[model samples]
Target: MDTLPDPVGSSQMDIETSQAGGTPEVANSAAKPRVRAPVRVEEAPKFDLDTYIANYTGRTRYDRLYLIGTCSPSLANEALKAAIAEAKASKDIIKYEKAVRALSEVAPSDPEATLNSAWVQETQRSVNAQTERLEGELKGYKNNLIKESIRMGTEDLGNHYYRTGDLAAASKAYSRVRDFCTTPNHITSMLFKMVSVSIERGDWLSVQSNVHRLRNSQSKPEDAARNEPKIAAAWALAQMQQGAFLEAANSFLAIPADLGDSYNEVLTPNDVAVYGGLCALASMNREELQRNVLDNQSFRNFLELEPHIRRAIAFFCNFKFRPCLDILESYRPDYLLDVHLQRFLPQLYKRIRTKSIEQYMIPYNRVTLDAMAKIFAPSVIGGEAKPTDISSPFVQELIGLIQDGVLDARIDMEKGLLISNQVDLRSEVQRSTLENFREFNQEAHWRILRAQVLYHGLEIKSDKKFGDGGKGARFSREGAGFD
Candidate 1:
């Protein structure tokens, strides 16, 4: 009756009212709430110090502060002190965090950075006390290793000295270590060191003794085999020094083939060439042996070990005149040259000159020229030339003055008298001259010819004739004259 005013609108209202309280429709029409799914987050990657330090460019203030803190303790402290002061001025969070991280990293190593003037002395005292306590705790452990390590340390020091060319120091240091070390490596090292020192000092017997010890030692099989060539070489040198060439040759031949290969591998090219030359000299038929050696790949490989030595060997082997001249001109007393000269000078001279006397004559001329050139320009030549300058300067000058007539008659006469006196007083003009010439030419009378030539040039012109018939004719015929 109350809703009779709008029956048209009331029809829809009556339908809603009838449905509002109905149990079956209300329960069925209830709305359901939506729920969200769980979110997934990834963890950050691990930090690496080397990478961080490597790429640390100071773009931001924090980055700049981090860089200063990580480099060194003193730098970190200085940066942190300034940063703390600046932080107090502005109360910046970034500045404060940077300062705190820096202080934490550097505080253990550098107390001064963390402690201001007000607390500096106390902090230092605390650090010193802590350091002393830690050091005291570690001392007992350190002392235990010292005695056991001393010999090894000293031996290593000796090897370092030897490598650096301080042979005398190395010898002494090695000797000291040798006395303390009894192990197989130590004994072998000591023997090798002694042998090296003896070789350098030219003590053949000592080298032999050390080489024997090295051979007999309880060294590793490889090391023992590796030492064979050196031992054999040393033994050969000792026998040679004792004037036993055949024995030396036998000793040299006793060296294993593999030992030579090992020696070649370890030695410098120059050393290989020198040793090969020595080994070649030890053979009964050196030319044939050398040909064989040169043809062998192993020996050629040895020659390839050092450019300088290889060049020298090639020059010597091929008889390359220019290379030999260059080597002589350069004036190094190389071991290869020494050994070759000792072993093959007679053969080389005969092959080149085709006469024994001419072979003798060549070295006489070489010695005279060398002595004269050395006196005229001392710095131009070295080794034997330098010593010859010291030993024969007056003789050289007398020859020069006499030949040139540069000195007055009185001075010339005096120089002549002085030469005659030297010849008389020392008997060295005859003896040493002969000995040096023989050593140079490997001939007995090489110096006698040299001296005769020197006297003839000094006393008489080549074209001049001097004689009182038969008596003077005897002297002239004998290639002796007085003007």
Candidate 2:
């Protein structure tokens, strides 16, 4: 929570001060930075490049690989080369050119960086020929006035446009298929194509809109069973992008682990595990984590694929803060390189860290600043305590927690301690009671006054005596809130 210039290390504390007992007092928070391990951006993630890439297909593969190529310095050249190869294999000249540009930026000496005008010209000619052919076919089908033939023609054209990376044209072509759709499956297929287009375009709201349409479509039980996992993953991705971590976790948790690579074009079981698990950690309580994640039999299969994430949840549930946090820290770099996770990582990690701080303080009513610092903001060298001074990041975090009401605790600066405050129930009740009585008295007076006005039938006429002609109005007890 502290905006320190130094790289963020895994340290969290919530500080407030108490003059006598548990009452909070505001104090200026300052933090002194102690050395912590600078995050190693070059650290390669646990998975191998080829194996990981093989888990996905379609544009997602390029997006993910390119993201890694751009974000992870250690994997840049390999990822960029892989991306270029994949792009070149596709009919999409746009994809190929984009990948070539990235490779040129990262590894100019690499052969893939070359524009390869020969391949470009060939793809250009092919794309033009294919587009004209598909368009001509669609025109013929339309002239025949056959709905099914028209639908087929439109879908073929959409597929052509998609392959050529003309997403706008592809999306329009796919949408055209909808009007010609004669059955549930046709509509479903059209919707799916639109979803893919929306996802590639980073249009999350469209993804959600189409997923909603898909869910409500007339799919049979078997179809639902086969498609539910894909739908859930897509919906979860949209929710994640929308910043609804808890809702996204619930959606992800609902995904059946048997999904395997069925949704590999957009997501994988490993992704389900990582995205769902991190979202859970950021938003769910220990009990919730246990119930929805560690104990959910249906999702256990996905968890098995990413055991590190499972262990992180387990550690957090067990209140093993240090190890839990360390695990998250180690994996942060990998998640940072993820296409979908990169933008949301800051918010997700912040929530997880803040929640960890809250959980750590749950069992303590009074704890020393040294003790808090040892667990949070520890010196990376020997796990030493950070300075309890106002300048300490640890102290600053505590200051934030106090101000934000995330922690009901106070700091005793001279004593170098955190003193927790329990809500004074008696005071709170008395305050509420006093406020309620005042409201009741005011209501009773207004009602009695109204009764007098009604009894006397005093229909006061508007007069200039009122500063604003319409300002002074009589109570119509009928329109009053209490009424």
Best by lDDT: 2
For residues 204-295, could you state the per-residue lDDT of candidate 1 as single tens digits? 68777787778788888987777767676667667655555446545544544454433321232333444454444333242444455555
RMSD per model, one decimal: 35.2, 17.0
Cα lDDT of candidate 2 equals: 0.77
lDDT (Cα, 0-100) at 320 in candidate 2 = 86
* Clashing pairs counted in every model: 1, 15
lDDT of 1: 0.44
- Mark the regions of model 2 whose C-alpha exceeds 4 Å error after superposition: 1-40, 380-386, 424-483
lDDT of each: 0.44, 0.77
| Residue-level lDDT tens digits of model 2 in 1-483 | 122111111112212221224211111111221222223357878778888888888878877876777667788889878877776777655556556665677678988788899987787787778878989999999999999999999999888777656666788889989899988989988999999988776678999999999999998889988988888899999999999999999999998766888878888998999999999999999999999899999989989989999999999999987788888888887888777887788889889989998898777777887777767666632532347787777788889989999988888998887888986666788999999999999999978887787788764533456543367754443555323
Question: If scored against the real structure, what TM-score would every candidate get?
Answer: 0.31, 0.78
